[model samples]
Target: MNIVVCMKQVPDTTEVKIDPVTGTLIREGIPSIINPDDKSGLEAALVLKERVGAKVTVLSMGPPQADLALREALAMGADEAVLLSDRAFGGADTWATSTTIAAALRKLGFDLIICGRQAIDGDTAQVGPQIAEHLSLPQVSYVSELELAGDSVVVKRTFEDGYQRIKVKLPCLLTTLKDMNSPRYMSVAGIFDAYKKDVQVWGLADIVVDEANIGLKGSPTRVKKSFTKGAKSAGKVYEVDPKEGARIIVEALKEKFVI
Candidate 1:
């Protein structure tokens, strides 16, 4: 089987800072890592590869620096890696981004596609499902568990309250959760071999996409503004009996129209 994992490089949230003047992310000195959920998805793919002898390919769309993320995927046991980079792809929103990635997936061909539920930078959680829609493929999101069956896969789709197990046929897409699997680390030999392998870089010309349906032109959503959160006021503290405290809390909620 050929498994394609869509990965992304995102700034480490802990190290992220906001630009006070521009109201945008300060990425100059911030380090980047593979999106945590995507890393787990990659681990899931690698596990399936080991169990069923499948070929795993990691794909990412971003600036050229994204190649580093792909190289890390190789070091974690992916058979191949592809980086989609181009100036034309800049400023793409979820729709345009999914369109471009779906185009590349068509070229690569795959029996299965894996993606994180959402990206850290953009928490819309729309790209994976959008890609499935673009390709007219069945998709299951928030997959917590999966097992390969003949010509199909049994997956457990998670929910806040519980989960549902469904058997879906091959050629489907799955958006995985970070808790699905523990990611493996890059070993010394794997790291050495990763450097030896070539990471294929493709631009807009390499994939088939409409000029109007990619980049900022195709993006329907725009960020009007961005800013850091303001400091919150301290909470009120009161010393009272349990019954009195409950009454006070209820009264406070009523005053705030929260209840």
Candidate 2:
């Protein structure tokens, strides 16, 4: 089986900072890591590769620096890596991004595609489904468990209340949750081998997509403003008997119109 995993390099949110003047992320000097959910998806693909003798490829779209991210995937046991990078792909929204990725996927071909549920930077959770829509492929999101059947895949889809088991045929897309699997670490040998391997890079002209349907020109949404969340005030605390505490809590709820 040919498995393709969509991965992204995102700033570590715990270390992220906002620019007060520009209202944008302060990316300079910040460390970047694979998106957690995407890493889990890669782990899932690696597991399948080991079990069924599948060939795994990692795909990503970002700036030139994103090559580092692809190398990390190679170090994690992906057989190959491809990076889609171009000035023409700048300032793209989820729709344009998916269009470009889907076009590339068509050229690369795949029996299965795995993506993260959402990106930490955007938190939109829209790109994966958008890619499926563009490719006209069946997709299941929030997959917590995955197993291969005869020519089909069985997955456990997670929900807030519970989970549902689903069976989908081959050539389908799946968006995985971070809890799906624990990602393996890169070994010394793998790391050295990863640096030696070449990452195939493709630009806009390489894929068969309309120029008008990519980059900022094709994006339907624009950021009018950006800002960071404000700090919240501390909550009030009280030490009292159970009965008094109950009354105070009820009164507070009523005051806040939450009761």
Candidate 3:
């Protein structure tokens, strides 16, 4: 099996900022890391490779700097890595991102596509389903377990309340949850290999991407504004006897108009 895993680089949540004028994420100088959830997806891909000795390809789309995430994937044992980088891909919403990624996957001709359940920065949970729709393939999101059957894949999906089992044909897409597996740390040898290796970079023109539906030009949703929430205050502590504490807290609550 040929497995393709999609990953994203996200701003460190604590340092994320927004451009006052554009109302978009101000990514300049912000520390970046692979989306936490995508690490699980990467681990799932490696597990599949171990199970069936499949070839794994890691794919990511972002600015040139996103090569960092791809290199990390390679260090985690992916066979090949591709970076889709172009100014035309800038400011792409999940819909446009899914479209572009789907087109690239079509060119790749893979048996399976794996992704994280959601990107940490966006947390919209739209890209996986959107990619499935664009590629016209079945998709299972929030998958905790995956097994390859004859010409099909079995998935165990997790939900807030419970889990569900589902079967999908080959050439399907899967969005993995964090509980799927623990991501393996990069080996010393793998780290050296990643540094020496070269990743294939594809631009918007190389992918024959439609200019009208990509980048800032194609995005429909607009962020009117974005601002960080102010830090919360630590409440005052009162020390008292257990019985007296309850009575005192009740009086304080009423005094504070919180009753």
Writing each residue's lDDT as its tens digit, candidate 3 over 57-110 gives 989999898999999999989989999988888888888898888888988879
What is the C-alpha local distance difference test score of each model? 0.94, 0.94, 0.88
Give the least accurate 10-residue stretch of model 2, judged by summed lDDT.
224-233
Residue 138 accuracy (lDDT) in model 1: 98
Better of 1 and 2 by TM-score: 1
* Pairs of residues at least 3 apart in sequence or in different chains that clash in candidate 3: none
RMSD (Å) of each candidate, 1 decimal? 1.8, 2.0, 4.1
Candidate topping TM-score = 1
Per-candidate TM equals 0.94, 0.93, 0.85
Residue 171 accuracy (lDDT) in model 2: 97
For 29-81, candidate 2 gives per-residue lDDT tens digits of 89999999999999999999999889999999999999999999999999899
lDDT of 2 at 160: 95
Over 1-259, each residue of candidate 1 has an lDDT whose tens digit, in order, gives: 9999999999988888877677677889899999998999999999998899899999999999999999999999999999999999999999999999999999999999999999898787899999999999999999989889999999999999999999999999999999988999998999999999999999999999998999999999987876778647898999999999999999999999999
- Number of clashes in model 3? 0
**What would you estimate as the lDDT of candidate 2?**
0.94
Flag regions of model 1 displaced more than 4 Å: 19-24, 239-242, 254-258
